[model samples]
Structures are given as C-alpha cells and as structure tokens.
Target: MSKISTAILRGVSGAFIANSGVGKIGMPAEYSAGVQQAAASGIPALAKLPSDKFGTWLGYAETGLGAALLAPFVPSRIAGAGLAAFGGGLLSMYFRNPENTEADGIRPSQEGMSLAKDVFMLAIGLALMTQGDDK
Candidate 1:
C-alpha cells in the first residue's frame, strides 16, 4: 500500500494539474496565443508551433502526467519523473525571462511569483522519486 503522505501529495497535485490541463484544452484563441507567446520566450522552439496546437499538446501532456501520478498502479518513481520534468520546464520559463526575475536574478519579480512557486512541485517530485516503497 502507498503511504498516506504519498497518496495525499499525488492526489492533490494530480487533481490540480489535471484540472488546469482541462481548462487549457478549451482555452480561447487569444488566451492560447498569449500563453504560447510567454512560453516561446523561454523556449524558442515553442514559437514554431501554432498557438492552438501548443495549447492542446500542453493540455494533453499535463492531463497524462496527472493521470500517471494519480494511478496507484503506476510506480512513484515514474510519476515523479514526469512531475520533475514538468516542474523543470516551468522553472526554465521562470528563469529565462529577465522580466520575471529581480535585479539579483535569483529572486522572483512580481511577474514571476507564480512561476517561482512551481519549485515546490520540483521538490515534491524529487521526494517521491527518492523515497522507497512503504512496504
């Protein structure tokens, strides 16, 4: 059986991420374009895709990742890997934009506060990955 702590972490984060993904799947064109533009600023390759495609693909990715995390049959390490990758991507976006950071560069500017909070997901993912099964 999974530990209670692990279950709670997976349940909460999975639900939140999945819900966010569902919302993005049906996002309006202007909103998709705006989000795509922001992401492109961090990873230039993202700019190559049309905004609608990017949003749909991102939504599917998030939904799949959330499902993986929520599935008890799935191994924690595997789910954690996905979460870690997602968190890393979000952090990259946060770090790559000069406008997102304060003068010190490490600290988050007002615009970056939301992105900076994604670090918790990275931490949780690492924790899940390293933890042994409860037995």
Candidate 2:
C-alpha cells in the first residue's frame, strides 16, 4: 500500500478505536445503554457482569488495540486481527437481534447504527492482513 493510504487507514481506525475505548471507560449513559443492549441482545453474560468491570475491560482492550494499530513498532496485521475479533463480536450481537435493525431488518436501528460502523473495522483488518502481499 502507498504510504498515504496506510497512514489514512491507521489514523482513522486508530482514532475510532481510541474514541470507543475512552467512551467505554467513561460509561456515559448512552454507551452504558449500548453495552446493556449488547448483553440483552445476545451476550447475556455481559449483562450479568458488573457494568463497571465490563466497561473497563472493553476500554482497556480497545485502547490497547488502538495503540497497536497506531504505533509503528506493532504489526498492523496483528492489530487488525484483534480489532476484527472485537468488531466481529459486535456484528454478532447485531445479527442476533433483528429488533436492533430497521423495518428492512438489514440496516441497524438509529442506536445500533453507531455499532454498525464496526463492520468497517473488519474490512480494515482484512485489508491490513492482505498487506503481507505486495501491491
């Protein structure tokens, strides 16, 4: 990949993860509600865990993943893989709950849309993985 493209991907994905990590830590009402929704939707275990603990774990994981993607010392593919797993988990939650989507049952509900964007992280992770090949 060209340097410009790589930089853009790194910057955008890094920022996104970083923001999510921070928000998870803060546990703002909206973010907390989203977490609860995830638990209620499919990840029932999350609902059982204390929200503070769950949010803290999520926050740290996201922060580490974001840092890895942003830092030159870390391999992008590895970081991307971690990010992909996280994003996949979120997608799974969305998939498990049709009610989270619109009437079409394809697009996410307004609240779910924020998480719907995590789909891009999966793509980004795949792209980074493919970077092992020469452009």
Candidate 3:
C-alpha cells in the first residue's frame, strides 16, 4: 500500500473502532436515559429497542472491522462497509426520535449527531470497500 492509502486506512479504521467502541459502551446509558426521559411523552418501549440494542451489535461490528483492517488476509472494504451500514442504521433511528429535538437541548440533539456519525462511518466503509489492501 502507498503511504496515503496506509494513512487513510489507518485513520478510517481508527475512527471506526473508536466511534463504534465508544457507542458500544456509552449507548446503554445514553439510550436508557433518553427513553427514561421520553417515557413521559408515551413513545412506547418497543420504539426504543433499536437504540438500546445498538450497543451490542455495534461492538461486534466494530471489532470485526478493526480486525479486518489490522489483518493481512481480511477484506478491509467489506468489513468497513458492513460496519458503516450498521452505523447508518443506528443514525436513522437516532435522528428520527421525536424526543431528540434541538430545542430540547444537547441531550436530544446529541442523538442526532450520534446518528450522523453513522452515516459518516458508512461513507468511510464504502471507501474501504473501494480501496482494499493494495498488496
């Protein structure tokens, strides 16, 4: 791999691992808090499952992508794209949450931002797919 490609892969991989890892750990608290806060508005329990369950899935997906990126034999792009799609799915629900509005304060809006990162991850994943290991 060229220097630029190496750098790109490293950077994208780093971000994928870090972002997903953080979400994987932080999501339970953040998601539960949101649901708890929004329960008063009657959002229903079922609606919150995606956000609540996202952590486990994100952790697995991120770990896979990290491994793929770091491994000599694994496919980087495929792993990156899969992880990215996972992130995008998370974001789709995040921004759509009725309780997570900008007017409410950072608590709600942060969810939107969190979801947006998923979209970004998806793009990175796509890039990885496009540019697999050169060697």
Candidate 4:
C-alpha cells in the first residue's frame, strides 16, 4: 500500500483535477473558445481543432490523468508522468502569453494568477515521480 501522505496528495490533487475536467466537459461555447485560444498559444497544433472539440478532448484527458493518479494500482511514476505533462502544458501556455505575465516576464500578472497556481501541481508531480517504492 502507498504511504498515507502519498495517498492524501494523490487523492486531493486527483479530485480537484477531475472536478475541473468535469466542469469543462460541457462548458459554454465562449468559454470553450477562450480555453482553446489559450491552449493554442502554447501548442499551435491545437488551433487546428474546433473549440468545442478541443474543450471536450481536454476534459477527457484531465479526467483520465486524474483517475490514474487516484488509482492505487497505477504506479506513482506513471501518474506523475501524466500530471507533469499536463502541468507543463499549462505552464507553457501561461508563459507564452505576454498578457499573463508582468513586465519582468516571470511574475504572474493579475490575468495569470490562476494559471500560476498550477506550478504546485507540477512540483507535486515531480515529487511523486522521484519518490521511492513507499509510494
């Protein structure tokens, strides 16, 4: 079995990510468009997909990743890889948008605060990936 700390970390992060994904699954058209636009800034290929389709796909991906993290059967390495990828993508998006950062280009602007908070997800993923068999 995993350690209590690991379990709690995975449970909380997984639930939050899963809930966010569920909320995005049926997002409004405008919301979907906005999300797509932001994502496309980091990954230009994403622009090829329709806004609604991108939103739905993103939701599914997040849900699957969250489920993986929450499942004890899934190794920390695997789950962490998924979380790292997801978190990295979000960070990329945030960095790519000038409006998201301040004049220094590193600090989060008012518009970027939400995305900036995702850094903790990335850190947690890295920590999980580096954990020993105790996980």
Residues 72-92, candidate 2: write the lDDT tens digits.
667767777877777787777
Which pairs of residues have clashing backbones in candidate 1? none
Root mean square deviation (Cα) for candidate 3: 6.5
Which residue ranges in model 3 land beyond 4 Å of their true spot?
Answer: 1-3, 10-12, 15-58, 99-111
Off by over 4 Å in 1: none
> Which stretches of model 4 miss by more than 4 angstroms?
none
TM-score of each: 0.92, 0.78, 0.52, 0.92
**Candidate 1 local lDDT, 1-135, one digit each (tens):** 359989988888888888888778877778888889988877889888888677877888899989989999988888988898889889999999988899999999999999999998998888788889734
- lDDT, residue 76, candidate 2: 69
Residue range with the least summed lDDT across 10 consecutive positions in model 4: 126-135
lDDT tens readout by residue for model 4, 1-135: 359878987889999899888878877778888889989998889889988677877888888888988999998878887888889989998899999999999999999999899898898888788888752
Which pairs clash inside model 3? Answer: 77-128, 77-129, 91-115
Each model's total of backbone clashes: 0, 0, 3, 0
TM-score of 1: 0.92
